[model samples]
Target: MRTGFFTHADCSRHEMGGWHPECPERLQAIQDQLIASRIDPFLQHREAPPASLEDIGRVHTQSAIARIRDHIPSPSEHYYSLDGDTFLNPFSWDAALHAAGAAIAATDAVVKGELANAFCAVRPPGHHATPTESMGFCLFNNVAIAARRALDVHGLERVAIVDFDVHHGNGTEAAFVGEDRVLMVSFFQHPFYPYSGTSDIGAHAVNVSVPAYSGGDQVRQLVTQNWLPALHAHRPQMIFVSAGFDAHREDDMGQLGLVEADYAWLTQQIMTIADQYAQGRIVSSLEGGYNLSALGRSVAAHLKVLAGLD
Candidate 1:
């Protein structure tokens, strides 16, 4: 089987504002990189379908869903702010639904043996939107919902989620706080935006807060010392990843100094863990990455590892 690549044009239509960092061009950058790297033809590709409200309800509250739908602006209107950072434009709701749906679909495909693994290239990136609130450019917790789906729909006993976003995946942690079926491991730049993962580490959550200006060596140490041990102990039946590239040194969004090689190494580590415990089942979804060139190159490196073309 091959790796499945999931995305949609609607994902590029969701606009927060003219100057917002989480613009629609993020998707285009990924698509362009896949073609440029000659990685496009090695995988199965599919257009993401809109997620049913029920799929999102697995990880988000009913009220949160209602509010996000209500926040969608009419085509005539320009934008509606969820907070100072996150906002909704004309196509925001459609894009959010599809972004989330991409995760669920990727999970399904990997679980059913239709693909060796999958990568979701849709956005606005998820990882900060909590179970009852939307924040940090995330409309819904896509990876969390996908994890829950693996447990609920696929009848998987245990699943692991690893997030390497520059910012902490507070939303994903919130969704699995007391849940034993899912284990979440993450590394993020602390003292940063939407800061909450610094404290209240959950039993099933291993959140490592790297200080600002840290380098790839520091990140690799944390993953080797902390994340790998927990993953081996848990022995998850499936693995999901919140693949964020905003930690690249060139990205102004965060202070971390991760390069494409760092991302490639991380993906290789995750693949090792998945091969050991999850029958090589892995689903990775895009989270955050702003600098177009870095994001594109980082994603290409990541997919290269996943696609075994490295």
Candidate 2:
């Protein structure tokens, strides 16, 4: 089985504004890089289906779902603000559904042995939206939704969520705070946006917050010391990754100094863990990455590892 790459055209239709960093072009950048690196042909590409509300409901409240469904802007309105950063355009609802759906479908494929692993390239990136609220340029927590599907529907005894985004995946953490079946490990820049991971997250979570300007070596050290041990002990039946590349040194979105090599190394580490304990099952979804050039290159590097091209 090949590495599955899931995405949808609808994802390109959801855009905040011309000025926003989380633009539709983010998806295009990823696609362009995959082609440039000659990795596109090696992937098993699939068009993402829209997620059923039931699938979404596993991780989100009905009211929260209603808020997004109830408030989609008409064509003439152009945009409706959900928060300072999050907005809903006419196509946003469909795009969000597909973004989340890509994660779910990918998870299903990986769990069922139809593919070696999968990567979701849809957006408005998730991981910041909690169960009750959609914030931080997110309408639904895609990774969280995928994790829940692995647990509830697939009946997996242990699953792990690995987040390497520059920002803390507070929403993903919130979804499985006390749930023993799910173990989430992440590293984010300290004193940053949404600023919530510093406190005691939960017994099942290993959140490492690094200071600004931290480099790849520091991150690797922390992962070796912290994330690896927890992941080994968890012995997960499957793995979910909130793959975000904004930590790249070139990305202006955050201050951490990770490069494309760092992302490739990180993916290798996660893949090693997946192979050892999870039958090489992994479903990774795009979470954050703003700088177009860097995001493209970083994703390509990550995919190289996932595809075993590296």
Root-mean-square deviation (CA) per prediction: 0.9, 0.6
Off by over 4 Å in 2: none
lDDT by residue (1-310, candidate 2, tens digit) is: 9999999999999999999999999999999999999999999999999999999999999999999999999999999999998999999999999999999999999888999999999998899999999999999999999999999999999999999999999999889988999999999998999898888756689999999999999999999999999999999999999999999999898999999999999999999999999999999999999999999999999999999999
Flag clash pairs in model 2.
Answer: none
Q: In model 2, which range of ten residues has the least summed lDDT? A: 196-205
After superposition, candidate 1 runs with Cα above 4 Å error: none
Separate clash counts for every candidate? 0, 0
User: Which lDDT values do the candidates have, in the order given?
Assistant: 0.92, 0.94
Cα lDDT for residue 254, candidate 1: 98
Taking all chains together, each candidate's TM-score versus the true structure is: 0.98, 0.99
Q: Per-residue lDDT of 1-310 in model 1, one digit per residue for the tens?
A: 9999999888999887788899888888888999999999997998899899999999999999999898788878888989989998888889989999999999998999999999999898889989999998999988998999999999999999999999989898888889988899999999887687877656688889999999999999999999999999999989999999999999999999999999999999999999999999999999999999999999999999999999
